[model samples]
Target chain A: MATIKDVAKLAGVSASTASRALHDSNMISEATKERVRKAMAELDYSPNYAAQNLVNRKTNTVGIVLPVRENQDSLGNNPFFMQIIQGISSICSENDYMVSLATGRSNEELQKNVQTLIRSGNIDKLIFLYSKKGDPIFDYVKQQKVSCVVVGQAYDALTDHIQYVDNNNFQAGYDAAVFLGQKGYHNIVYAYTDLEELVQAERYEGYQSYIKQQGLRDHHLGLSRVDNRANLEKLQSFLAKNPEIEAFIACDDIQAIRLQRLFKEADIANNRYALLGFNNSLITEIANPSLTSVDIFPQELGEEAANLLLKKILQESQTLIIPHQIIERESTASIK
Target chain B: MATIKDVAKLAGVSASTASRALHDSNMISEATKERVRKAMAELDYSPNYAAQNLVNRKTNTVGIVLPVRENQDSLGNNPFFMQIIQGISSICSENDYMVSLATGRSNEELQKNVQTLIRSGNIDKLIFLYSKKGDPIFDYVKQQKVSCVVVGQAYDALTDHIQYVDNNNFQAGYDAAVFLGQKGYHNIVYAYTDLEELVQAERYEGYQSYIKQQGLRDHHLGLSRVDNRANLEKLQSFLAKNPEIEAFIACDDIQAIRLQRLFKEADIANNRYALLGFNNSLITEIANPSLTSVDIFPQELGEEAANLLLKKILQESQTLIIPHQIIERESTASIK
Candidate 1:
């Protein structure tokens, strides 16, 4: 209930001095600032953020933009986003900054919402949860000259102009195939959804390169977002035609699980084919055979992104690659 | 970059009138507001939210409080919180209000952070993501008289004074028992963790009531948040002693999956016991044997809570009970 005037009187300083001290403005001497702080502590004064924001021209808030996924269900079902958010939220909380989410069902809506968020001056910085080439939101943020960070691979054109944190998804895919091959499973295939996404493209490229280097016949399976009847039939036909395929490397854990279900329906025994997935999420542990997955360290990616965005001067566009680790589980236990 | 003055000039009104019209203040005529809207559209003007907030004394932001769990990993592992947040985010975005997350590692830290959020005048409303009996955060928010809504059951003392949205957890528990009972499973046991939470306590009470009514010997299993060796040993012993228990109703899908893993290790056959869990989350679909779960409609709960908090007048302290349904899956398909 104590006002700035009261704090100023108790600290033996003018109201303006107390206000400046509250913000730790260099204009006020350290002695006066310390006196004002003690007075504030004695009176338990909590400065109004809105008022301070106006004075400092800073909101002390971060905006997190979630990609508008084609499959809306993925927005809720995917634990990857939540894990990254957890990492981001932890760092933001520690820094005394609040996090605000910006999401939409479509790109147009997402762009408009983000525009409004930035124009409103409610956020000091922004963190894009995903990255894609030629994203309008990315361009808009760049034009606005706002301090921002991306949590995935930036487009090649903007690589030197943007700050991003990502796992070496290419290496992850190559490693998955190599790990399975090391176990003597030479007939391995890559499974993915939405090859248009840079993540899928990069990972597939890595897998394809490995296959070519080893002189193995390369086979890949594409899946729809939803597990509809068409998808099941496709999986069944693929399995029937490629009976020699002994293992699969999926782009994500969810896809791995869905494929596992489809494989079961096709009457394929669990041990008949080994499976490896990415994003060692919770489902990996609960999965029927307990999935062998690549841990991309999503939380660390988020944390690094936040750290980059909060930097005082983002003079040099920095790219931090969080390492990925392959976790061996029951699904990949088959030894030759 | 057009200002209010430009809009006012184009609308043939004073700057003050244009500002009021922008807010759609009751004092402004509909004709004048329409004129100002046209001018704003023509100029592509965006109002600075901080300045507007100062004038309106409203932040147009919602604070979401996540419970401080003893097991920190649960904060990220459990999809329940993320689902709720997605629901809250969608609704808040629709209303053009930003959602801010308030989280901490301990009860004391959570309380302090929430207090700071409120006192900072940065949020127009607050939503507590979890409910616990006699929680200090609940008491503090109530004392502050902030427009707030709880996403779980209010304690008995505050039931009449708080607005809350929750599933009938007790009924969900009772229904789980009845669903299994109707399947001709006479011997049923309940599995849960941390009964101190009202959710666990209420569900257990319902399960216990059904067991006593049916003249069946009630058996229960308690597991820790993490799958530690101690927990595995405890589960092993419980299963060893309750070999005759035909069905198990778990408090959540995650716990059910954990139990399934433990049961597998103990050499219990999938067909040997019918397993049912709550919170029909993503894990249910991925779990081996797939879990039959009670869909508590978590997103709806979150949406309803946001709706209640954003209401113009929360005079009645409304309590909404979202209905729960049993989602049958492979885990509970056996008719024995």
Candidate 2:
């Protein structure tokens, strides 16, 4: 229950000096800060952050909003978000800032959660883990005029008004095809679900363009998100009719694994075809053949997004692109 | 900025009534609450939570502390924490609470991070994701008199003093061994790392007890956490020397997958032995022969922990045991 004044008196420093030392201000010498800290610790003086926030008009907390997904399992199963969160949390902790996670099972719930967070004035900045066209959460945050950063692509209309960090998904897709081609996979197919997400669309576009430029036949296979039986039949039929296809590039690692499982169920020999995936998640390394994946460096994406939002010069909209790499593994090793 | 008073005046209510409505107090009638909400929305009034928190002496935030590990990749690679966080976040969002993550790469760093979280007076409660004997973080939280719930087993000395939610790990191990025996496997070996964690020890104990009670020969393998080369060789030699062993029970899914990978490198046929793992993580399904694992239900553990901490009765120390299930898959199918 000791106050800053008491700590200052005990440390033989002025109250203002104690306060500055508590904030780790450059104006306060390390020796004085150490003395004040020792005195505070000795007196069991816990600083009231709520009161400090009121006075400074700062919360020293960042809000991380996860996207609302229809399949809630994605949130739990995907390690990409976890890695990004680790990156963000590490940086935030280093800077002495707390992280507040906002999540919900539905869009309305997510919006309400975010509204409550922003309205409560508990977070000074917001970071959206995913972005999409005409997202209500994005619109709401923008209307509230809260400083925020998006970790994925911003819509064309709002790109000028938002700061974002992303990988070049189109280029990532193109690079995947090029890598597979170099690995001697001539007839490569692109397989994805019906989610119609921005990243998938962009990547598919890149793949399509690469195929057309190479004068090769471009094959696309769409799988249902919910109906695994139909997907199995679809994959089986696709393989049956296209015996010449050498590889299939999935939109992400999860899809890649799903396809790999389907291939096994359909009695397809592992060496007959190659598989490539994105996001370079842990699953890629655990998959039977140890999948070849595009390492999107999700952690770096998170760190850069946090840095952009926390940067003092927040007036201008900034875009940061984290590079992606092709990690060759056993799944693609058969082709070589 | 619009104030509560302004919204109250616009809604034809007293400031106290408006405050109660904002907080959704049962004292305020539904009609009045709706009117106040409408007026506040019209006036674009955002409540100052810091001031409110100062008056209420509550931050409405829970701090989640992740265990410090020697390998940082474990934090990112493992999906257990992610699922647990999802469960915790779902319940927290429902009750209008924010989650703050405290992470560190080392014990000292974690202690400092946790100390800052507690001393900053920013969180009303703490949840430790893992429990260890003589953990400084746990000791610090205990000393600070902070309400906390541990998601893993508490040490013998602190069991009566602390609340915890954990699966009956000892029973889980016994059940795993029983499960393998029921699948017609006579010789089973328990494989684990050298970390000396409580859960592993308990599981191994159960396995050991089951083997003794059933009059079966017991086998045990200790793998290094860091040295994969040594582990690969050890596993190879163990398999070579013990051709009678029909199954290997891994402490968790990660180790199970590691063993599977090593078996492949050692040129062991997939059908030669059954692999059983705990945690039933995504990796179990993705592994080539799909590992059979014990579903410890990490998310449920998280939910139970949060419920215990947030329960109104804070005086009594309580322990909640989440049930575990054995999910049968391909890895064990060959033995059957």
Candidate 3:
């Protein structure tokens, strides 16, 4: 209800001087800034981010688009997203910025939302959680040449560079397999999801590479795609077929928890088949016997992503990796 | 960057006609509305929420103040808030709106952010998650006659005109005691948060009332103060002094889980102690023997809160109460 003129009158300064002090623009004296700040606080003066964005071409709001399909694949019930978001939010809130969420079903819908935000001049920066090859979302980002940072890999088809942070899933998978081998569990299996997603594929490859490295190239690889009912059944079938398989490594913790349920149904004794899970979500700790899990530091990953985006927005131009810790709990104990 | 004029030109209509069609103004026909919609899809037109908001004096953005304290309430460990937020987002997204998070050390900072958004004219509604006696955050809502739906209750001094969706904490506490009593437990203890929080105090009353009704009015009560450490120590002291207190009811799952850990350290087996927890959060399920807890449906509560806020925003004015469910897990068992 109060205007800049009222604030200036209350602060005993010219309207132009008050405006400059409020904006902290060039040439505003510190004394004037303090006077203006106190007056603004008294009057509850709030700046319109949208109007300011129109004038100065900055919104100071980041758009986070989480595209949830029919299944909400890789997302629904995943604690990982929450931690990453907390990380991003913690930094954003500290820096006096706000986060907005957008959802889409189809590529067309995703493109519509992104384009609408750009054309309507709502958010200046966008952070996408999911990435795809030849994504239409990327097409518009490239055309507008707006700032963006993605959690997943961007397509090589576009020349627009994006800052990203990802765990070394391949290396993690390799290390899990190698550790099991050193523990004398030769017939190890990799329980995975999708098998199409880049992260899953990389981990699968890592398991294969590690097996070859350990001269156990004859190992049987077990595949169980999560979300598919048949995949849950395949886990049970795999157990029935492979008595020699003493250790199993899951691509992620959710899948590992599911397998633990099946193992209980089979009445399999603990350590009869060692289990290792990834991402170290609460599921690992909740599994009846607890679970050995790879800690991806999702919270740190989220923080790094936010910092990366902020750096890019500020033109600092930095990129880096976040380390992972292997938390050995009850699930991956040595087989007697 | 296509405007209504471009859409009108492409559709062979006047600019005024396009505007009427987009707004569904009576001046336009249904056929024209369909044509304009198709054109909008092709050109990716997004009816500017801000411009509309400025004209109508309502942005439809709801502020959810988290009350993240200076000490930071260790909420990072649980997935409860995350699920609630996602549920809130789902409803907001469906109604074409955005949810912004607000957290501050003191109520002054909280009021500052709210005032900022209020002045920016960016949000038309508020949903305060945490409320304390004489809370400054609720002061703005009352002083400004703002349309707000608080998630929890504030001080009795605060105006009661503002709507809220608070859990029946008193009922939850009564049910915990009743359930434990039915199981043949004689000396049950009540463990909870600070009495300064009106909701927790209600729960304590519920426990006391239930015990009085059962003719066991001398039950032990342990109040876990604000800091988790303080609560832990209080719980430790309760265990040290009361050996006859064979059963305990924790106000929340987090507290119950911590109590279980303490019991383990004390060489007292869980289920041996008959622990019951409120808010069937992930921690309860993940704890040893799985905690028996009351499912408050935090996500559903969030959805309910958002629905109520939007209803008030649209002048629909309907107040509702969402129920709590009791989940009987392994933390407590029947003595019979």
DockQ for all models: 0.51, 0.48, 0.22
Candidate 2 structure quality by residue, lDDT tens digits, A77-151: 777788888878777877777788888889988997898788776786999999887788888888885888889
Which model, 1 or 3, shows the larger lDDT? 1
After superposition on all CA atoms, how large is the RMSD of candidate 2?
Answer: 3.7
> For residues A1-336, could you state the per-residue lDDT of candidate 1 as single tens digits?
889999999999999999999988999999999999999999988787887788877877889999985543566677678778877877887777888888777898688778878877878699999887778888888788578888887676344467778888888888888998898899988888888878887888889889989999899999886454677899888978998988999988888988877776667776778999988877687666788999888778877888877754454546788999999988998575
- Looking at candidate 3, what TM-score does chain B attain? 0.84
Q: Give the chain A TM-score for each candidate.
A: 0.88, 0.88, 0.86
Please provide TM-scores, in order, for all candidate models, with all chains considered together: 0.89, 0.88, 0.77
TM-score winner: 1
Worst 10 residues of 2 chain B by lDDT: B310-319
lDDT of each structure?
Answer: 0.82, 0.83, 0.69
What is the full ranking by DockQ, best candidate first? 1, 2, 3
Q: List the residue pairs that clash in candidate 3.
A: none
lDDT of 3 by residue, B163-214 (tens): 6666777887788788888888878887665566576677778888888987
